[model samples]
Target: MNASRKLTLAAAALALTVGGGLAVSSASAEPAAASRSLVTTTAWAKVAANGQILGGQGITGINKFGIGRYNIGTAAGLNGCALLGTINTNGGNDPGPGSSSILVGQVNGNTLFIRTATPSAAGSAAVDSDRPFSITVVCP
Candidate 1:
């Protein structure tokens, strides 16, 4: 797909995730009912440019997620940010072949994000074996 289309889908996916998360946490909100604390959390995925991911097939790498942290009060500080990230390939369209990686996530207030902006030379691969993989971030 084109660049803009990819971004749109990503955004939609994020909305669904954050929306679903609210329901799961609804049970916990009961305890804070008397405290007047309002909590909002968001999670999203970040994808490396096809070029960056494709290049670092068999290489050690460092990627970047442009993120920051925020919160409006004492009761709602960001406590945790983590990421479950990986790529997969059957080895066809793209040449880079690699597995998934779990890494620390970036913090932005109660918001969370992750991305692999940099790709370096790995041990045995030159081109990314996976064409399209996902990077997922979560926060609590």
Candidate 2:
């Protein structure tokens, strides 16, 4: 099978597994009645195009509903700019049971958004975040 077909099939499988209980908490809407599951991935240290390793820290974990947080700990590499985020299951393809993680309150400056699945108005599910997320800097 082609890459596109494989991605589509993986997405479909994720949708069927997560179901409707998973949702991204919107600013205007109230938090969903159902609680969310938290998950964490392996940490990524500061890596640059050059051979130098700048000071940086990362915490990969899904907060609620598959919405993950990749927090950057150090300030050296962060230039008031945008970054990319991706998510996947622990097995890299299977969205099954996993561990949980979260913070009490306050949106920290380094906190970034990562979602495992997106819901459509027609009731269909769009699976985006699934196992290993590749996060990078779009700007300097």
lDDT leader: 2
Candidate 1 has a TM-score of 0.29
- Candidate 1 lDDT by residue in tens digits, 36-133: 64433333333333424333221223333222111111123346534455544425443333433323344445332333221343754332222334
Q: lDDT for every model? A: 0.36, 0.37
Q: Candidate 2: which stretches are off by over 4 Å? A: 1-79, 87-107, 118-131
lDDT of 2 by residue, 45-99 (tens): 3322121223334543323333332233323234454454433232444343343
Compared with the true structure, the alpha-carbon lDDT of candidate 2 equals 0.37
What would the TM-score be for candidate 2 when compared with the true structure? 0.28
Backbone clashes in model 2: 7
On the 0 to 100 scale, the lDDT of residue 40 in model 2 is 36
Alpha carbon RMSD to native, model 2: 24.1
C-alpha lDDT of residue 26 in model 2: 30
Error of 1 at 99 (Å): 5.2
Residue 60 lDDT in model 1?
28
